[model samples]
Target: MRRSIVAAVVGVTALALTGCAGGGDGSGGGAVEKATIAIAADPGSLNPITNATQAGQEVSAYLYETLMSFAHGKDAEGLLAESWTESTTEVSFVLKEGIVCTDGSELTASDVKASFDYAADPETASPYSGVYFPAEGLTVEADDASRTVTFTSAQPQSFLLSNIGQMPVVCAAGIEDPASLDSTPVGTGIYTLEDSSPGQTYTLALRDDYTWGPGDVTSDTEGLPKTVELEVVDTEPTRANMLLSSEINVAEVGGTDRDRLESGDLFTIDVPARPGLMFFNQSEGRPTNDLLVREGIAGGIDRDEVASVSTGGRGELMTSLVSSFTAVCVGADATTSLIGFDADAAAASLDEAGWTVGADGVREKDGAKLELTFVYPSTEAQSVVAGIELIQQQLGEIGVEVTPAPSSSYTDVIFQGGDWDLIWAPISTTLPSTWAGILSGPFPPDGGNWTYNTNQEFFDLTAEAQQLAGEDSCDAWTAAQASAIGNLEVMPFAESTSTLYGAGVEFEVTTNGLLIPTSLRG
Candidate 1:
C-alpha cells in the first residue's frame, strides 16, 4: 500500500458560499424552485473543449450534452445520438429527431461532425482530443438529411463507442466561432448557462423543452430543480455546514465531515474513487529512477496506515488503480504482486544499492545525500497532511530524507517535469484503456505518461488489450496492470467514497462522479 498527494488543484476562482435561510431549505417547505450547490473550485474557463478540470466538468454537466450517457453498466445509453453502431475502427451514430440546441436551432448531424472535426484539429489543442476523439487518423462524415454521423479511425480502438460517445459536442455556432464559447455554453443539454460571475457564482436555468434525455427521462421529471446556483466553496467543512443548515441543497463533503453529514437526514450519493496513489518520477537523474531505492521506500512505508490516516479510516485499501464504478474486470488481483512492507528488507535493499548511512542519519550514495522531494496537492483534507507526515517519518526511519512539497499547481509541476521524486495524484477514468496511456505512453511534453515508464511487458500487454473488445480484453489489461504494479511504476494505495451530501436535493451521479443534471430533483 502507498499514498501520495493529489495531482490536480482547486480552480482559480474563490468566493464565499452561504446557504439560503428559510424557503430554499430542503425541509419540503415552500416550492423547491431553486437548488444551491457548493463547488470546491471556480472553473476558470467554461469552454468544454479546452477545460477538463473537475470544476469545469461539473459546470459542463449542466451546459453541455454528450452523444451517449455514461452509466454504471458495461454498455452506454444514448443521449444526443439516439442509436450508435460501432466496430473496431468505425462508429456510426444516428441523431435523434426533435433534438434542439439552446438557440432553438435543430441539432443536425452536421453539427456533430463539425464538433469532432474541430476537436480533432491539432491547432485546437484540446487535452481530451486523443482520449475522446482519436488523436491520429480520424475521419468524420455527416448527412444532415439522414441525421447520420459516421466516424472512422486509422487504428483499431476497442472502446471507440464509449470513448467518442462521451465527448461533449459543441453546437454548430460554437464550432464556427470557438471564441464565443469561452464563457458562454451553446449545447443541447437539459440546462442553459443563465449567468456567470467568474470567481464568484454561476447560474443555470432548466430547459423546458429538453425531452430527449438519457433513456426515457424528460424535462417534466419530478424533483428536477428549476434553477441551479453553483457557488465556489473551497472548504469541505464549510460546505458540510451549509448542507446541515439547509442553506444549500447539495455539496460534496469529505474527511471527518462525512460522519457528521451521514448522521443527519440528508441523502448521500457516493462516488467511488482512488484518492491516495503514489507515482515515482522515473526520469533520468531522479533518485527514484533507481529501482532499489523505490523498493526500499515501498518496503519501509505501511500502506494500511497511510490509507487509514489519509481518509480518517473511511478509505479501503485499493487493489488496483481502476475505481469500482468503472472497473469492468474486478477479479484481477495484480496488486498482490507488489512489494509489501518490511523495514529490514528496506534497509537491506538500500545498503545493497550502495547507499550508506552518514553522520546526520541520512543515507549517502556517490557522495550525494539520499534526499527526495515529495509533492502533493495543496487542497486535500487535513487528514491527507497527517498521512503524508506519517510517510515522511516512516521513510526517515529508513535513513531517507523526505521533503514534503504541497503545491497548488500540482498538475503543472507534473506536466513541466519539475523537481519531484514522488507525487500523489489519483487517476480517475471510465475505461481501462485510459490507464494504459496514462502509465506507459510518451512522457510529458509529448503525452500524459508522467512517470516516464518504460515497461515493455506492460506496453505489449496493453497493446494486445486495445485490439480486443469488451471482456475479451480483460485478461490482457489485468496482465498489463500487474506488470506495472510489480515494477512499482505507480502505487495505488487507498480508495474512498466521494460522498455528495444533499439536503433537499435528490440526484444521481455518473460513474466518474459528475452529477447528472437531468437526475437533479429538489
Candidate 2:
C-alpha cells in the first residue's frame, strides 16, 4: 500500500508556458514527447520489496509490475498473471505467455516464487512481507509446464489473492542482489530506468514490448508518453510553480495551491486517502503504554479542528480507522465513542491514571514528566503541519507535553529507530485484513507492529475476520476495529482527498492516489 502525503509549500507565482500538444505517435508537429512529474522525495532504493517510502512506491509502479492491480470498488485485475484461482487457504496464478524481463530473460513461474521467497525470508528484512505474505505456514511452488505458481497458507486467508497479487514480482537478479537494486533495478514493467541522479531526478523510457498492463492498459494504448521524468521536488510550491511554467507536467498539490491550479486550465484529480492518524508506542517502556494515557490522548484531540485544518476545510472527519472506500468493512464506525473532543474528560482520565498536574502545567507521575515525542513527515503541506500543531496544542491543554519532530523520510525513522513516543502516519490499504497483519505482528525489531500493541482481543478478531470472506466477515472486521479503537491502539481522526494537479498533461489518479502512467497524455 502507498503511504505518506504530498508536501504543500508557499512560493511566488511564475509565468506559465505553453507546451506542444501531441498524440502517442510523437509525429504531430512540434509535439513534446517527454513529460515530467514531481514526487515528494527520492526513492533511496528502487527495490520493490525493501522500498518503504510513498515516493519510492509511486516510482516503482513504473519500474515494476504486480501480479494483480486493484481497481476502486472493483475486483483485482490481472497484470503479470492473466488468470487466477483461489480456495480458502490457497491461490493459484498462471503467468502471461511470452513476458520477458528487461534483462531479456523469460518471466517464468519460478521467478515469481523466488521473488516471494526472498521477501518471505527474514534475512531479506522486507517490511511488506508480513502484511503481504504472512510467514506463518506460507509456502510457494511453481509448475513450469503450465507456467503456474501456487501459494498455500497454514490458516485460512480469505484475502490471500488480493494480498499476494499486489506484490511486485522481481527477477532472480534483483532477488539475488537486493542491495544493488537501489541503483540498478530489473523488472517486467511498462518502463525501464534509463538514468537517475540519487536525489535529483529519475528518467524512464517506455518499453515497447510491455503488453501486460492492468485492465485496458497495453503497449498499444493511446496517449502514452514516450519518456517520463520524475523530478524530485520536495516543496509543493516549487512543484506548483514548475507545473505553471510547464517545467513539469504533473504533481501532487494541496492547500491554496490546489485551488489555484484548478482555477486555471490544469486538471485536478481527487483520490480518497486517510488524512490524520495517531500511532502510539505501546511497548513496555513507553509512557503511552498505559491504557489510560492512550485513551486520554485519543479523547483529547478535536477531530473537527484537525480535519478542518488538515484539509483546509475540504475533508471529512473520520469516525473509524477504516476508510469508507474499504468494500468489505464499509460503514464501520468503530471509534465513535472511543475518540472525541473532550479536554476535561481527557484531563480527568490522565489524573485518574495517577499522573497529576505539576507546577509547570505538565502532568507528572513518580517524578517523570508526561512528555511525548510526536513525529510527523516533514512535508511542506501546511495543513498537515497545522494539524500536527493543533494536536500538540490540544494534548498540551490536557497536560501532555508534545515535542514535534519533522522527518524528511519517516520510514527510516519509523522502521529503523526506536526513540519515538508517537507517529502521525496513516496507512493506506485496499483490504481491511492488511490492518490485521499490521496490528497482530510483533513490535519493531521482530515485526511491523510499530505501535507495539499487545491486545489479544484485537488480534483474535482480526484473525477471525481473515478466516472468512465477503459480507460474512464484515462483523469480525468491525469488531477488530472496535477493539483497537476501544483500547486506543490507534487514533484515526480525519479522512482527506489526495489531489493531483496536471499542467500540460492529463492522466487518471488511482483510487489510492497513484498516478496511472499508462494514462498520461500530452
Candidate 3:
C-alpha cells in the first residue's frame, strides 16, 4: 500500500522536537519519554468507522481499540473481547470487564454493536463498508447485562472472526454524532488523541487506565512512551535525515535511502505486501473492456522486469491477490492463472481484436486509436515511477500509445473513477473474503467494488468457500483466487517487503502494516 501526501509541512524542523520533554507518566520510572514517528501524509480522518486508508488506520491503531488482533503476525488474540464463540452463520463475543472509553464511559456490548451497524450502513459511505462485513444481510444484537455482542449473518461468511474482529470499535458518543469522530477520537484505546494539526502533526497521550492491550501487554509495560507524536514527513530522504539526527523515533524509508538506514544500527521491521498490481477499467467503452485488448496488454510487458524495477530489485513475483504474510493459507500462489509474457502473442491478440497498425505506428480500430491513460500514485518510491515509465515503453512496442497519468490524490481516482483506462493500485488483505467484496458486488460510490469489473465464477467459488470454516476452505479459496486471476479481473505481478526503520524505538508491525502500539519500546 502507498502513502498519501496530503500537503507538504512547513517548519517541520520545529515540529520534530515539539513534545520532547523529560518528565514522563511516572509509570516505570519514566524510562521512555516521548516518541515522534514520521508518517508520509495526513491521516484523512480520525474516525475508525469512516476511514480505511493505510495512514488513517496506522494512526487509529493507537486511538481506537479492536475486538481482536493478529498479535505480531501470529494467531488472533483477544483485546476487547475476552472470549468468543463462532459457527457457520453466527458469532458472539463476551466483552472484557472494566473497559472504559476516553470520555469516562464504560465500554459495553451496545457500543460495539453500534460501531459495526454504522460502518455496515451504506448511507454512511464508509470505504470499508463491504470490505469489513457483508453490507446486505447482517444482524447485530447486544446483550448489555451479559456483556455480549452477537453478529448473525444471513449466509455463512468465511473468516468471520478475522474479518470483523480487526474492525476498530467506537464508543456510543461517536456513534450518536459521527461528525465528531472526523477530528476527535472516542474509543477505549491505549492512547487518546490530545491535539491534531491536519497534514502536519498529531499529539497523543497514553491512557493510564488502559489495561486491555494485545496479549499480556498493557500501558504499564516498561519503555512504553508516555506521549506519541505522529509527524507528517512526506519525503524518504527527509525522514531518513530526521532518523539520523534523532529527531524522529521511527520512519519507513524505501529505495536508495534504505541503504543508509540499514548501515546504521537502527532496528528494522519488515512486512511482505503486494506493491505492484494492475487493473483495467471494464466499465463500458474503454479499450480494456475487450478481453483480447486486456490480454494484449498483459502479454506486452515483462512481469519479472516490472517487479525488479518497481521494488528496487527487492521484490518477488506475486502469486495471488493475498499477500505472503497471510496466516490462514500460506504459500498459495496463483501465478499460473495469469497470462505469461510474449511480445509476438501480444501483437497478434491486438490484430485479432480488429486493431490494425496505422502509418503512425499506433493501432487503430473503427477510427479509434489504441491509446490508454495509465494512472499511478505519484508519491510512490522513485523506483515505482521508473517502473511505470518502463511499462509505457514496453506497451508502445506493440503499437499501443500509453499516456502516463500521475496523481498525488490516488484514492480520489480510485473511488470516483477518474478518466483512466488502466490503474496501478495495490489492494492488500489477509483474507480472501475481503478480496471477494472488492472484486464483485456493487461498483464505486455504492460499495467496495471500485474496478467496475466482476467475475461471476470467482464470486460463486468464494461464496462456496465462505460456507466452510478456517483451513477447511483453503481449496475453495485457492480456486476462487485463481478464477479472478484467470479471467484477468486484476493482476498482481510484484510483491515488496515494507521496511520500517527505528532509530531509538523498537516495535513490531502487524501483517497488514499497522504498528502495534503495545509492542513499542525504547
User: Evaluated with lDDT, which candidate comes out highest?
Assistant: 3
Q: How accurate is candidate 3 locally (lDDT)?
A: 0.79
Stretches of model 2 off by over 4 angstroms after superposition: 1-32, 73-75, 215-220
Question: What is the TM-score (0 to 1) of candidate 2?
Answer: 0.91
Backbone clashes under 3 angstroms, per model = 4, 2, 0
* RMSD, every candidate, angstroms: 6.7, 5.9, 7.0
lDDT of 1 by residue, 210-262 (tens): 88998677778776788999999888899988888888888887777876665
**Worst ten-residue run, lDDT, model 1?**
1-10
Q: Provide the global lDDT of candidate 2 against the true structure.
A: 0.76
lDDT tens digits, residues 1-522, model 3? 111211101111101101111113212223558999998878787888777776788899988888887754356778899999988678899999889999999999999999988997877777766677777788999999999999998979888878888899999999999999999889998999998899899999988988878767777878889999999998889999998898998888777786766556566655654368888888878888888998999999898998899988877787767766666666666668788899999999999999889999999999999999999876678888788899999999999999989877677887776788888886778777788778877777776677787678888898999899888888889899898887777877777766676666666666576678887777
Which of 1 and 2 is the better model by lDDT? 1
**How much is 87 displaced in model 2, in angstroms?**
2.6
Candidate 1 clash pair list: 4-424, 5-424, 223-521, 223-522
